[model samples]
Target: MSIKVENLKHIYAPNTPFETIALDDINIEIKTGEFIGLIGHTGSGKSTFIQHLNGLLKSNYGKIFINDLDITDEKISLTDVRKKVGLVFQYPEYQLFEETIEKDIAFGPRNLGLVEDEITQRVKDAMQLVGLEYERSKDKSPFDISGGQKRRVAIAGVIAMKPEILILDEPTAGLDPKGRDDILRNIKEIHEKEKNTIILVSHSMEDVAKLADRLLVMNRGKVEFFDTPKEVFKHEERLKQIGLDVPKVLDLAKKLREQGFDISDDILTIDDIKLEILKNLKEK
Candidate 1:
């Protein structure tokens, strides 16, 4: 499914002396089966915008459409909207409360009122999808699992519902290096296998640079750039001006370019930077 937000506006503590505009005239579109990254500094409205996607927060002004359905319509069912656009908030693992891992992962499907057989199947599929072994972890306490596995179990809870559009807000906020990498890889695998729209909100430039096919940079409640990663990162100076930095390798490539090398400004991955360096060395 696709999603579109037009002229979206949200104000926290509106009309009071503490009024704050969290989002201002925000516009965005996500095509079906696309992987999109939403990046912004703290208090830049990134979280505010995603909350509107699944009706977690109603917009003060503007409209949201999910596959031609106006989510803002009073007659619309938010339950259906949420089922289609599942949101996994930051530190989702903290919300797990069931006694066993299987029960925890089954929570969403059970809430959906799926039949017993279907719920069991969903729990099994979701556990496998997140790299958890169903036969091994089903009866164990989720709290006893490793930190990374616990996070995966939490993600599997949402995956069990099988939403068409999955939105993850800061999925790797507190994980260690390996945990972060594992979560990112699992997310990529899920997106490719499910062929669903994926919206990832993250502060790590490196993570988004590697994962997202398209990038949207937000600044002060406004979209600064919305394009492919190559196109967005090309504006290195502007990104830095807004307190966002380019990927580490891209920054290094820019330094190389400043030294009179013929490296392309669009270089993003470490492999791309290596190839450019090798090519330049060969040229000399």
Candidate 2:
């Protein structure tokens, strides 16, 4: 599904001493099937902006359109909107409460009033999408699994809802390197197979650089930039001014360039750097 935001503005504790603007005059569009990375320092309105996408938070002044339907309309049903926009929050594993993994993953489908057969199928598909074996893990207690497995189960719960637009906030937070890699791989596979629009809110520049088709940078209640990762990272000084850093691989590429390695400015990943270095060596 496509998304368009126009003149969006939101404030906290409005008309009070503690009042603060959380989102200010924000506007952007996300095309269908695009993988967008949402990045910003803490308290930069990233969270606030995403909440508006799913109607969790209402803007004081602005309009939000999902596929040409103005969701900001007062008469619109947020419940229906939520069905199309699934949000997987940070530390979602902590919210797991079902006795078994299958039940937890099936919860959303069941809530949608789907029949037993469809619910069963959705649960199975969701589990499989996240790399969980349906026959092996379905009956196990969610709490009994590893942390990374639990996270997958949590994500599976949202996936079972079959949302066209998926928003994941810090999905890989607090994981070991291996666990992080596993979760990221699952996300990539989901996007590739499902062809759904994905908004990944992450603090790791490397993660976004590897996966996102475009990066949406947020600042203090405003948009800083929206462009491809390679293009956005070009403004290293501007990013630094906002307390953000380019991926470390870019730093390595910069150092290689300093040493007359002729590395291209478009290199964004470790694999890209590796291939470039090998090619340069071969030329020498």
Best by lDDT: 2
Q: Model 2, 1-284: lDDT tens per residue?
A: 99999999999999999999999999999999999999999999999999999999989999999999999999999999999999999999999999999999999999999999999999999998999999999999999989999999999999999999999999999999999999999999999999999999999999999999999999999999999999999999999999899999999998999999989888999999999999999999
Model 1: per-residue lDDT, tens digit, 1-284? Answer: 99888999999998899999989998888899999999988889998888899998999999999999999998999999999999998988899999999999888899999999999999998988888889989999999988889889989999999999999999988899999988999999999899999999999888888889899899999899999998898788898888988889976886898999999766778888899999999999
**Candidate 1: residue pairs that collide:** none
Question: How well does each candidate superpose onto the true structure, as a TM-score?
Answer: 0.95, 0.99
Model 2 C-alpha lDDT versus the unseen true structure:
0.96
List residue ranges in candidate 2 displaced over 4 A.
none
* Model 1: residues with Cα > 4 Å off, grouped in runs: 258-262, 278-284
lDDT of every model, 2 decimals: 0.91, 0.96
